[model samples]
Target: MTITINTSEIPDTATEADRALKAKHAAMWASGDYPAVATDIVAALGGVLVDTLDIRAGHCVLDVAAGTGTSALPAARRGAVVTATDLTPELLDLGRASAAEHGLQLSWQVADAEALPYDDGAFDAVMSAIGVMFAPHHQQAADELLRVCRPGGRIGVLSWTPAGFIGQMFAVLKPYAPPPPPGASPAPLWGSGDHVRQLFGERVTDFVARERSLPVTRFADGAEFRDYFKRNYGPTIAVYRFIAGDPDKVAALDAELAALGDRFLAEGVMHWDYLLVTATRA
Candidate 1:
């Protein structure tokens, strides 16, 4: 269970996603009811966490890079004492609202994933759904995840499956919206989920990788999706700025999604691919 990251093709400069990750994404999440979208995404992957981590009631859980608490809320409901930590404050704002609405109480902290400001072995399990992939320094990030949990604790992570339709969507998006300046490694974390266990001494006792298509159930139309990009994608704001005040942009996007629906959508399912990673610490 050796996890060796392949970063040869990644750029030396912080790829676009690092700098503008939160601000634009928060804006998009605010524009539309992204909480509903988050709920659906979380539901699609919930069981994997339950089985893989053996998460039980009253377990102390640390969700690093916890975005919108999609996984945190479920883990809390399972009776795990959850601390949802993220780098951005505004994201915490969103996570707080979502948690309250669900009647789940989560300990929220604003902190960096690489340099966690927590006591060692503070959590029984650590999970970061779709989080570590965004780390500029993948190895450092992995080390931190392992460092915070007690001996033999569990570590579960989610990553995006690269080169699928979602990959193509991101590729198509870079031109429309270039990523902001990077902070740590200056490289975009692309194609990283393939092998990550070696970074943790191969202690991932029960490892399972899953792929699923996330259907966007609530988007009003492609225009709505495009609006979502402004908050979620690294390059959306710049792209939006370039085409700002254009009345026809929404119409053009609607047409594009309608055309894509013929091939990708079936019965209103806008398929998005993602990878779910689960492991244990030795």
Candidate 2:
């Protein structure tokens, strides 16, 4: 199957800076085999988010920043009309292939979370699992999520919390990373209840939040975990790419990431924490 990505949907009003940042984002995610990481580690969270939204047959659902349709596929399985969107076309292409293999019908589109192309209130339930949170602008992404859902419709987000395994991993990588785009907040802030509420700001109500841990037993130890992420996770791979010229920096990163994994490991498993938030459009 051939996959074509049309960037015509991007808002003409978007600044050149925004376009450049998004391009970098697309390349970073496309650099590594993210689908493998998603399938192996956090696949179950998709179903969890789908159930949280109580998605019913015929409901229109949009999965923002959906990488490989984790939550989107489950929602489609439940008979919801699902459209999965991501900034990286490569990921969306893989997702489309997976959907075909499973005989699940859904639409996959290349989209920016901060500026979604859909009309306001076009969906019954809008969601993102370990997605959308990575958008450069949190408030813009939150506004887009709210804007796309109908009144009283459900909106759900699942993200890695600031104190979780994924978050700590980013922390270890931060010192070696380049400066972020202007006005962009940390992605993990979406995992915080207060931060999310502040972003939505009375535009949504009946908010509910929970923290859950995904047990990881795939790695025997910290070094193995570090090696897996370096090969399969885009962000980790991106960090390595930036520091590739300096052997000392690369060695430092390797040591720090491995130590982080070791600290999180317990009894042959590491539990990664994530925040799940559900709300209704006002």
Candidate 3:
């Protein structure tokens, strides 16, 4: 049985500003060729997460904030019934097309990480791969992640650590980016084991955490890495967009990003640190 949610109804209390911000968020992600970014870089991270969850055939899986089915496709390949949800429909369209090409059967839906529409305990396993951490409301998103998971079901998440290359990149971009919404937590906080424990609290058990590195060799040097992200990554693009009118600020951000990449690059590879967390819904 394929379970799905109807997303036609927006919350009654959603303010105009809230709608506008969500529109902007959707635009930022849709602005880039993120599917290429996923395919070219970080492709291995998804399979690693699926293995951690021990997803099996016939398991009902939900991939929240799934970007082009990074983890969803892998789960489907294992013969699990998969539902891949993301806030951006453009990305979902590409993911659907990719799945069609591979003969992988999975449902794709547009869904917000903070307000998932499914019934309680709808999935046997719930996961996200560097996806849910970007939601503006951390606690709400975390609650939704746990809510949809069946009791004793597996839950897994993989995110970039605060001290890692991607996290440092966010730090470098923070100065130039616009202020986040009220109560919005920094995305890198999801990578902290301590922070996640606080969020999940006693609602989950059998907790396990691992810090690992994903070696990237896609870019030959720091400048290339910066350029690629500027063209492809939404957050990086948003930062550059914020300072577009000032040549001086633009140049400064450019140099900073290049330098950050160079600092991480070693022996023709850059090691990106990430946190992998797994637990059972109590």
Q: What does candidate 3's lDDT look like per residue over 1-282, in tens digits?
A: 779584455354556776677788888999878887999999988798799999999999999999899999999999999999999999999999999999999999898888887888999999999999998888888998999999999999999999999999999999899998887899999999999988999999999889999999998989999999999999889888888999999999999999999999999999999999999999
For candidate 1, the per-residue lDDT at 226 reads 55
Better of 2 and 3 by lDDT: 3
| Residue 248, model 3: Cα distance from true site in angstroms | 0.4
lDDT of each: 0.63, 0.90, 0.91
Candidate 3 structure, TM-score to reference: 0.97
Winner by TM-score between candidate 3 and candidate 1: 3
RMSD to native for every prediction? Answer: 7.4, 3.0, 1.5
Point to the candidate with the largest TM-score: 3
Clash pairs detected, candidate 3: none
Among these predictions, the greatest lDDT belongs to 3
TM-score of each: 0.71, 0.96, 0.97
lDDT of 1 by residue, 99-180 (tens): 8998997889875676676766778899887655666566777887887887778888776555554555555445444444
Sorting all predicted structures by TM-score, with the top scorer first, yields: 3, 2, 1
Clashing pairs in 1: 3-198, 13-186, 14-186, 16-179, 24-231, 25-231, 25-232
